[model samples]
Target: MATPQWSKFFPDFYIERLWDKCIKCRRCVSECSYEAHIWDSKKKTLLEDHSKCVGCHRCEAFCPTKALIIKRHPSDFREHALWTPWFIKNIYKQADQGGVLLTSTGCALPYKNYFDHLVLDACQVTNPPIDPLREPMELRTYIGPKPESLEIEEVNGKFRLKKKLPPLIRVEAPILFAAMSYGAISLHVHQGLARAARDLGILYNTGEGGLHASLYEYGPNTIVQCASGRFGLHVDYLNAGVAIEIKIGQGAKPGIGGHLPGEKVTEEISKTRMIPVGSDALSPAPHHDIYSIEDLRGLIFALKEATEYKKLVFVKIAAVHNVAAIASGIVRAGADAVVIDGLKGGTGAAPTMFRDNIGIPIELAISAVDKRLRAEGIRHRTSIIASGGIRCSADVVKAIALGADAVYIGTAALIAVGCTMCQRCFTGKCPWGIATNNPELMKRLPPEVAYEKIYNLVKGWTHEIKEMLGAMGINSIESLKGNRDKLRAVGLTKEEMEILEVKHAGE
Candidate 1:
């Protein structure tokens, strides 16, 4: 195969530098992880190679003098309805590379987002809205099974319940930091998530990557994951967190497993993952032991046994067709919580086809699962924790109203800490330092700094959630769970509204 000449290739981004404002500080060159800006010693100035730019905008943000301007390339092929630029470019790149096209973060395809079509209701005459600032509002949530019926007995003057309650994981807010594992992101980022989760009184999932020894101190707020790969898994590791999440499938690549290239597996990551350094960590498509619901139930009990019944066990599955039925089975299998990850979920790396094509939206999945469980009289058996492309406080509120006990924020959390979503995480060259392990790149985002950013983001979102709850005349987040009447659909079809369990806007 003949290599395409540089002149024939199309560059996605074009860089413009204002030389008069440029201080010759060489900061852009140092800041760009892609090495797009090169110092031409002979020319005595900086020269940019646009082809190397992934459009992360790190250079533009770091330019001290505001001398850099990054924008889309002006050139383009003739436009066609069928052959859009995106498709044409994708084909060109694939034909050149002759391999699977990989991308990072959530699906970029323009699918109808159900959250946008749904609107919330506010109290007015009969049910007056409460002022969150003046009155108390509850966002605290518990994740685990609730007793079918509490047995009570009256003794003397005081009445007391008879049966003991099951173990539950409590959080100050219904928002959780989703799983982004080690070897996939820098340790500094992990530390930041852990510290923030602790301070905010919530939980952060330690993706499929095994728990790092340093983060063990934050175990109370951590949820360690056990994926098919079983990287860095052990007795102590299992007990290191408040809950254990069995990652059956993630939304980003529903039917596929995970692949962390050997190059990103450093010594520290190797130790944490219990994999040899410089070896690719691949999780099999399915857990060899869990081919049936009975097999899944066995593993759930095995983990409970491993933890001595001290920690809650969660089963996470991608939101796909018949998701409600799958969730029902998982609940009956004795999982304390069921995590439903939607199609828009983010990932460090995934085949472009799978990320864009697999899984259903979390909104519909949450509603379906909640309805199925309620119909089966097992709704209280497991908490529904929704994940995938959840953005902003409104999405969180909408998710709860759709039936999620809580929601997980993955991409949004990284964005809070300077991830530009350049789709370069798989390359291990994240310019903002959120996804890279390179020493220099890692220094760009210190744990303390990332922690502060994450803390502020979640705090702001929590405040907004409270305001929304108050507006709905509901003081507790629990009241919003599966309260579909609080929401109304706009452009959604009858089927969509039915699945979401929400009424039409006028009705």
Candidate 2:
């Protein structure tokens, strides 16, 4: 068969070459939702729009031509030493007076191995293994306050409201999608998360950017975040969610304010956030009204009053030294739950030094916070959610075993929908459109496909979690929370061992 004339204009040479090998099979074009490939009848060729290609590999996988091959462009770095370290070092020295090392993603810092050094325990010969398929395992969890003690009472000729509150909020799964602000990501990405959350029966967080009007339908599965700027905050915004999260800090830029550059503050974002167009939306590190724990509590109560005690209020803080003490104060401040974000948590943009050099690890923070809460006899009053570098199902299980009521996944969710984590999210030039603010780039991530990928990834992880729980002979995730006894420290120092309160294996 002659090569189709429509294949001549393909922007990607590789795709064009592959199109030339097509044998009139519609499989590749049919499987791709973006209509990346089209059969041109007049030209007798398969045309491809490389710009719409998300690099999902669905077409390549289904192509019978063995013709489609997606790959990264080759780099010739050695050919240009001007861009190398020595040259860059001199440039940095010359520019050092005022230049900041700008970065646009999560921490790329080398850190302590708290999560990796610790290990989980499985049943041995002494303990018979349980079959996950045959057993009933529970991953159900609640994410708010629990009663310390309950008293049964009956009213005169009537029954009073139950002393114990119907678990502040129950979740069928212990994994949730973390906050990726609307300004940082696109509307389709947010919509995808919301749809996936509804399908999976889990919750999706609206980051500090404020909830968009189009996503209000997913309210029951949404956790709206209220950060320092208080963007788009109003009576309707307050009432439009299952829970409210107050962002005190983020793991990526703990001690710094968040600056969403004016370039990305488009009309939609401006309206959603109630911020003016062409002005940087700044989120200061500390709320001006909150100077102390007491002040924090006051704000918490103010929000509670504003919402009429209908929503569960969550206080989110970055993991840092003395985070345990901070968590205790947040719990005492009347937060229904506390979200701890460790150093590796993601960001749209932050100074490179801050992203790499700040904050503690989630594993250590979770362990320390749980211990402190229990020691203070306040563990029962508030739940704990952990986010930062949660890469897999094993991470989720280990986080819960270390004492997280749930694990929040941001990067993983982005990866599920084709993010390469190139760390250029702030540039608004995301090739897959998962992180860009540009409308043309943003539209690359179609809601239907992106949502499906997220749903599949979470569903796969959930099944793996069930398998792990079954193997551990634990039926419910609650039974696993804070069960450090099931975990063993492998390569810890005396101080680290003491802090984690775990022993080396076979000791």
Best by lDDT: 1
> Once superposed on the true structure, which residue ranges of model 2 sit more than 4 Å away at CA?
1-98, 152-167
Candidate 1 per-residue lDDT over residues 353-464, each given as its tens digit: 9999989988889999999999999999999999998999999999999999999999999999998778889999888888988888899999999999999999999999
Among residues 3 or more apart in sequence or in different chains, the pairs in candidate 1 whose N, CA or C atoms overlap within 3 Å are none
TM-score of 2: 0.82
Tens digit per residue, CA lDDT, model 2, 1-507: 754343222222134436467677777666655666788889876777764554556567667877777553232235564475434533454454455666666788568757788777777787765776787777778889888877666878776656648337667799899988998898999999999999888999999898899999999899998888888888898888889998999898898878788988999999999999879999888888888989989988888889889899999999999999999999999999999999998888888878888999888899999999999999989999999899899889888888889989999999899876657677665667787667776777799988999999998999898888777777788899988887788878878877777778777
Q: Worst lDDT window (10 residues) for model 1?
A: 1-10
Deviating ranges (above 4 Å) for candidate 1? 5-8
> How far out, in Å, is residue 137 in model 2?
1.3
Model 2 C-alpha RMSD to native = 7.5
